[model samples]
Target: MKTKIGLFLVVALFLNSCSTSKTVGKVPLYEVLVVNNDGGANIKFYEILTEANEIMLLLGDETLKKKVKKEDAQKSSFIILNAGPTKETFNRATVQKVLEKEDAIEVYIKDMQKNVEADLANENVFYPYSIIKINSKKQIVIK
Candidate 1:
């Protein structure tokens, strides 16, 4: 009986070792690019993550995607400045603090419409892409 028990334990261990479990990762449902509409910044795309009527933008690459919690992304707006493209890839990001939506939009519109060489002093203009979140009424309100 002891030998049989040992054999059963060995079989169980083998089965456990051979067993595989699938890991489900958060997949990006929507992708939007914040482009300059001018000839300046390197454009990059973000994956929009939504939950509980709130939204967050996740930065992703070819293989892996990072998850953004709704609370952490609760800001007036996000800004993505051109980080400059490397020989291997083009990376744009919102590494800085979130700015006011109006401020970001003003900068973006100015950069897009203006071609004044003198205004190039303030050329590092960033754009804003407002994420409208669904409210309790099921109506989309700009966040």
Candidate 2:
């Protein structure tokens, strides 16, 4: 009986070792990339939080810094909603209605292909929903 019990324990341990589990996280799951295209090429990443009026900037793979940038947070959420899976299934009118409630204004920018292309390859460094371009005058431009 002792030998049988030992064998069972060993088998259990082996089985447990073979079985793997991954704890999939939900919060802090969304990512946005901020690329400085005003000829500076200063690239950055942030974890967007729409409800709390704050964002956590991802400095590196393991470091995150939180800041309260309400305007940026709101705009980022708006762009994501307009550019994400919801837009793929819903009509423009429906999406507009949802966005209207948040007072999310549409940002427009033109002739940014040369600037945007400069940092296109850097996008691989972070997963961004959409990148906003800033001009020399520090104006937000959406390309």
Candidate 3:
């Protein structure tokens, strides 16, 4: 009886450890490059927030891409974002072209709170048996 009890306890402990060791889909704090394609000469960087709201700086472009070699891109600043599945690479000329575009580009992680806020704000409300439209509009309009 004593030996059997000891074996059971050992098995329970092992199972507990295994369960705790499993990897959950949690966001990690890491940096990513945000190449702005806008015509603005100045380069702007922002930190990405993980699912847990952890922020990390951008570490510049240092990945393997077919066209853009590692040496071609310049390291500016750091920003935080969730680590993506595939690595992204960019060349100096491509970065320049991206910077030259009309829209400003940023690479950072978004938190769950922001996602919730956006979802709550973007919904449409309807009244029962009536044409009542609940239009949730923003106060400020940027041109």
Candidate 4:
């Protein structure tokens, strides 16, 4: 019985240690870039990350929610930026370069648009694109 109890305690401790939640914290600098495809209609592509290495999709934006509702953005499929292709990669160098030339957020969005254009072009599909930038740090929230 003592051995069984010890085993149970060990398993419980192991499980407890394994179970964890993501700790959300403020990054020194973060940016959010959005790309709206005219073809998708209601969806907007977003790429968000911080200098601290935290990156993910943003599904809950009150302002964007309102805009989506007002602008009928629900019909569209909003995609998070994929970090695969060399040109599509969102890294510190690209971010810094954009920040140096123009607004960080603007540069991010422009780069996103350019990436999308290049992607579509590689596929030989032509379409219109629009890029929007939210430069404020408040634009990126950790959750």
- Provide backbone clash counts, one per model: 0, 0, 11, 2
Over the stretch 16-111, how does candidate 4's per-residue lDDT look in tens digits?
Answer: 999988999853232334432223222223444432222212235533443332222322222243322223223211233223223222343323
Predicted model with the maximum lDDT: 4
**Whole-model lDDT values for every prediction:** 0.33, 0.30, 0.25, 0.35
Model 2 scores what on Cα lDDT? 0.30
Least lDDT summed over 10 consecutive residues: which range in candidate 4? 70-79
Residue-by-residue lDDT tens digits, candidate 2, 24-138: 9643312333322122222322222333233323222132223223344333442221221121221121111111113333343222121122233553221223432111112
* Clashes (candidate 2): 0
lDDT of 3 by residue, 12-129 (tens): 9999888846568743222223332222111222221222212111112233133222322231222222211111121112111111113332322222211111122322311111
Over 1-143, each residue of candidate 1 has an lDDT whose tens digit, in order, gives 99999999999999998999898985322222343333333343332333433333333322113323344344322323333322222223322221233222222211222222223245444322222111122211122
> TM-score for each prediction?
0.28, 0.28, 0.22, 0.24
lDDT of candidate 4 at residue 87, scale 0 to 100? 35
- Model 1: pairs clashing at backbone N, Cα or C within 3 Å: none
Measured with C-alpha atoms, the lDDT of residue 131 in candidate 4 is 25
Model 1 residue runs over 4 Å out of place are 28-140
Q: Rank order by lDDT, top first?
A: 4, 1, 2, 3
